[model samples]
Target: MIDPAILEPLADDAWPARERKRLGGWRLNASSGYSMRINACWPLAAPDRDVEAAIDAVEAWYAARGLPPRFKLTDGVLAPADLAGQLAARGYREGKDTLVMVGATDGEGDPLVRLSFSADETFETVFTASAGDPEDGRERIEALGRMPPPACFARLDVDGAPAAIGVAALGGGFAGVFGMRTVPAHRRKGLARRVLLTLLSEARRQGVERAWLQVEADNAPAIALYAAEGFQPAYCYRYWSR
Candidate 1:
């Protein structure tokens, strides 16, 4: 079983300041208010008799901020007796399920067929060419460029045209795989898989032993690819929006 402690560093690494901290081992991450990735509660510590008090504190914190209380519980956390039922009783409706896929970098399946990583210009070109909105793409590119160079990005180019983009952030003995996107025209050409492999390679180069990523449960294709790449569902979590 994967230990919940593995997620401790996410508070400062992945989560942004807009994410609000709350009492009772709960956090109200408002950074991406409407996005499942941002708005959720993570029980960093094991629940005990004080679990109710912790829930109350979180609810109060949200109420004080004029935001509805939202909570997310993963398979790693659900083993706590009645945790889900407790949240449901307090009007927290379940949202879509997501899988926490994890893998180690010691062994790789296959080398990416045609993928490479370069500086800002190359990443910008791929992001701009693939995103639906050119302006939004530029903003994303700029944001990613500001990140430390250790944050590796890989682009899959097909016939000299940018087809997919992948990014990984290294920290705290782990590499987080995120920001994966493929151009609509290049769907199902194995571009996503190639990009993922490239990210893993980058992670391995960074001396990161473990890699982790999250994907919606309904995204069967993505889940299948991760599974084929030796990733296992270490846990599952769901978001609730009021």
Candidate 2:
């Protein structure tokens, strides 16, 4: 039940590139290359029908759209007992191990952090500075272009330029936080912490009591930072790519 429940914010925080469709009890999403969650099959329920055919349908759908076939499956109660085996039989390999961290939204905001309602130049610049290229920043902005209501982007300027940036979306009593990035030269500084605390404060202002974010399992610095901010791992998920 936690799996289905956790999906509430994820589904609510839809992007512009999202082309979501239902396959029996599964949600097949193809968002081009925007975000992995929107481009992977969310196998939520155990199908009573043709499971293999359903899997084939999903693969065919992604192939027709020229998307890499991917499945985002969580551990324990969130994943089907036989899902891993089924995917293995299909030549699917695991990719991008991630952890879903949860925390409270009672932290105080920092005056240095500035929040915006939409993707502006400052936000783009901070992203470009951290993402290492303009194409990655543009792709993210393209996805954020269709972000739903009650979303906010946070930026922290250093030496009159944006050094830290993050984004959050409030939905279903949870604030979905992601894309927290800091410029290379600005790393090891406390700008990211300020931005995080500020974003948590904003989430509280938006009436959200809980905060959630996904980070790659191998990201030690980020995991340590979030843990220090009172965030704890709720579940783990990995992409199975065919």
Candidate 3:
């Protein structure tokens, strides 16, 4: 089994945030406040100060930035066991349970899918067009641009029009997939699967051993797709906000 403790930092580094700080092992991140992962605090380990004091600091930090205090609690043995109860007592309600999946990276890619070292205009166009929330889309697009090297953006087209897109950030023998999107008219066409496989193929080329991605628990179709690709749940995390 893939260890959540080891995989959490890889995923965080793959998707960068605009502003970041640390309270000992706890990670504080904030950006446009649309994407919960970037804006929420990740309590992966114990803080340096008292747990209550650390929570207070997190609240004040977000307040200073005109955003709500939020925490990302990974549900596993590595996470601080009592932190959830502490947040609950402080009026933090749990939201958005997301499953983290892990899979092997040993497959061939679709030659039809174009892979770029950066996010190109067509990639951005398809991503923004398919996004339901403009601000959230914008935030994610910017994050995609900020990802460091050893990364690639995948785009697949049908009838000379953009159909689907995905991004992979690679490092330390791991590949983290993000920003998988498909045009509305192109749904159920296996475009996403092509994009995913293409990305994984590239990761294998770069010597990546494993691939990981986060998907909301309610997304049944996405879960099925990941499962079919040999991905299994490594762990799950939830957002906590007052």
Q: lDDT winner among the candidates?
A: 3
- C-alpha lDDT of candidate 3 relative to the true structure: 0.89
Question: Which residue pairs in candidate 2 collide?
Answer: none
Candidate ranking under lDDT, highest first, comes to 3, 2, 1
Query: For candidate 3, which ten residues in a row score worst on lDDT?
Result: 74-83
The sequence of per-residue lDDT tens digits that candidate 3 reaches over residues 1-242 is: 77788888887888889999999889999999988889999988889898889999999999999999999988774446898899999998998789999999867799999999999888898787666799878998898888989898999999999889999999868999998998889989888999999999999988887999999999999999999999999889989888
For candidate 2, the per-residue lDDT at 158 reads 92
Pick the winner on TM-score between candidates 2 and 3: 3
Q: Report the lDDT tens digits of candidate 1 across residue range 1-242.
A: 46655653352355343545645345555442334444456665554438787777767766776667777766555334577787778776788897778888644424543434434576677666665677555545544554444677777777887778777777777777777888789998887887788778767876888888888989999999889888998777776555
lDDT of 2: 0.78
Query: Number of clashes in model 3?
Result: 0
RMSD of each: 4.3, 2.2, 1.1
lDDT for each candidate structure? 0.66, 0.78, 0.89
What TM-score do all the candidates reach, one by one?
Answer: 0.75, 0.91, 0.97
Query: In candidate 2, how many Å is residue 90 off?
Result: 1.5
Worst 10 residues of 2 by lDDT: 1-10
The model with the greatest TM-score is: 3
